[model samples]
Target: MAGRIAAVSIVEAIAADLRNRIFTGDLVSGQTLTETDVASTYEVARPTAKASIEKLVAEGLLDRGTHKTARVIELGPESVRDIYLARAYLESEVLRRLARDKAVPGDAVLANSEIAALQSGAPLDVVEPDMRFHLSLIDAVGNERISRMYRSLVGEVRMCMVRVQSLHLLDNALIHNEHQRILELIESGQGDAAAQLLDEHLGRARERLVAAMGGTAGPEAALPSTLD
Candidate 1:
């Protein structure tokens, strides 16, 4: 039992480390991972490393081979578009429901908190909080299935964000302003307008990520990876 627990811990640790590398783009798409290399680096056994890689493969963040080889899954244009499409559908539904039902009395408070956290120039836990904010809306809809799927999708989205190295806290005056506006629309029961604003906001964010990754943008253009 002790050995099993230890093995699970090792595998989870390795999985998290590799996930971070993949998210930060340090392990780019198509980069192969060898069990031998990972075992040596993480000081774990080959089986443990294999387990870690397999976990990520199941998460759709890594691709596995017939043998024990694994590689980071690359996001092509279509994959990117599909991701946004899923997000748009889910978020728009949540927003529409919230506006119609007037659920979640603290919309303004949550939005203000997020904006203040972003503007404070402090390292924001953007990924987790972003997931929470969106999920909160889905939960308000009282749909178990949609919420479950949204949670699953959030994991994939986070993986993509990590792959693009786009979760850092930075000063995007425009983003801050945009977020504020969306919050205002939601608060005022303008579901349609809020949904439109969210779509545009997410689109701009995606564009900035692509531009930053392609080296078309300046240093401040890319999202930072560090929590702080």
Candidate 2:
């Protein structure tokens, strides 16, 4: 049992590393990965490398092909649309509930602090605080099931965002402005309006990212055929 658990942890760690590479565009869409290469790169056993690749396949980040090859999964237009729609639905509802219940009374203050942190030249990770802000809103909704789903989906969402950031397509200022608007709406007790704004903000962000990636509107389009 302990051995199995250790193997699982190792697999998960390799999966995370591969996911980061894919997200950062270091591994482009349809790029083939061999177990041998992965084992060498990660300094793990071949079986462990295989397990890691399989895990990414399960996460929709890779595809297993014939000849014992694993290729990065290509996200098409439909996937992009679906992801954005999911974000809009989940985040908007969370904001609405927070406003209606006055659950996030300190939202403005928190958001402003996030903005300040971003402006402090801390790091790209620090600049991407919108996810945390949205998660706080999710917590306010008080739904364990929804929260679980949100947690599961967040990795994919962050992967997509990382690609957008790599392309320099995402505007931090615009994001900060949207957050401020949402917070103001929530603080003013306009739950419905806040929800609507959240939807529009996310929708526009998706559209802009798609446009920046040459109007492909998908992960494949966002990624190059090969990494530089």
Candidate 3:
């Protein structure tokens, strides 16, 4: 039992390192990963390396097929569009509810502050705070189903964000300002306006990210009209 526990811990540590590397662009999208390569690099057993790769695959950070080597996820046009659409829908409702109730989430405010502080940090460093801010908004509504649905999309969203940052499509100051503005709108009890702004914010990001990925004939091709 103890040996199994220790092995699980080691797998987690190695997986975490690889996950960060992927997020930071140390391992680019579609880069292959093999158990032998990971084992040699980390000086771990092949089983341990395999477990780590599997873990990442399950998290949607890596893609693997039966008898195929794992590779970092590469988001295409359709996937990016679908993800952003889902996020916009889910978060738009959350923003509307919070605005109607005039209930601001302190955690979201704190996460936005953290985002402001990390303006000069590596692109990946801002991803957590960005996610936290959105998640806090969802949690504020106290809807378990909505929370779970949003959580399911987080892994893919982070990957998209990594692409957005790597391509220099995101401006830290702009992000912070947009988030703060949404919070203010909610506090002022402007539910429809807050939701509209949230939709627009997500739509702009989706269009840019999809464009950067070389996807679709145009931004309007894949994105919903509301986002435009």
Candidate 4:
């Protein structure tokens, strides 16, 4: 039992480090990882390294082809559009609910503060905080299923952010301002307006990312315009 526990811990630790490497672009998209290479680098058994890679694969970060080697998943234009569209739909509903209930998410405010603190030019620095702010808004809805669905897409979301930043396409100050405005609109009980702004905010980011990835933005998909 003790050995099993220790092995699980080691797997988790290795997985965490590999996850960070993917997020920080140390492991670029389409780069393959062999179990042997990971075992040698981390000084772990091949099975342990395999388990770590499998964990990331389950999280949607790593893709294992038929050959069973893991490679970082690429976020092409279609992927970028779908991810942002899903996020916009999910978060738009959350905003409407929060607005109707007049519930303000404090964690979102804290995340915005973190975003504000970063230097304006460092787009990568704000990605996690920006993601946190949106996650906080969804969590504020207090629906476990909805939050789970949203989180399932987060790995791809972070990958998209990394690409967006690398292309120098994000504006830190603008994001902060937009986040603050969305919160204020929710606070004022303006559900529809808040949802609209949230949709527009996400839509712009999605289109820009799609365009940067060499894809044309399609017609806007409609979200629920009002709370149920």
Top TM-score prediction, candidate number: 4
lDDT per residue for candidate 4 within 114-161, as digits (tens), equals: 988887554458788988999999999999999999999888888888
Across 96-199, the per-residue lDDT of candidate 2 in tens digits comes to 77777666646545855676556433234643576677776776677998888787667567666666566666556666766777777887778898887776
RMSD after Cα superposition, model 4: 4.2
Tens digit per residue, CA lDDT, model 3, 1-228: 999999999999999999889888899889999999999999999999999999999888899999999999888878898999988898888888898889999999999999898737667778889889999999999989999988878878988887777777767887788889899999999988888877767777778887777864444424433322
**lDDT of each residue in 72-106, candidate 1, tens digit only:** 88776456657867888898877877777655536
RMSD of each: 6.1, 6.7, 3.5, 4.2
Order by lDDT, highest first: 3, 4, 2, 1
For each candidate in turn, the TM-score is 0.72, 0.78, 0.86, 0.90
Model 1's C-alpha root-mean-square deviation from the true structure amounts to: 6.1
Backbone clash pairs for candidate 1 read: 23-162, 23-163, 168-224
Poorest lDDT segment (10 consecutive residues) of candidate 2: 219-228
**How does candidate 1 score on lDDT?**
0.67
Candidate lDDT (C-alpha), each: 0.67, 0.71, 0.85, 0.85
The TM-score obtained by model 4 is 0.90
Q: How accurate is candidate 4 locally (lDDT)?
A: 0.85
C-alpha RMSD between model 3 and the true structure: 3.5
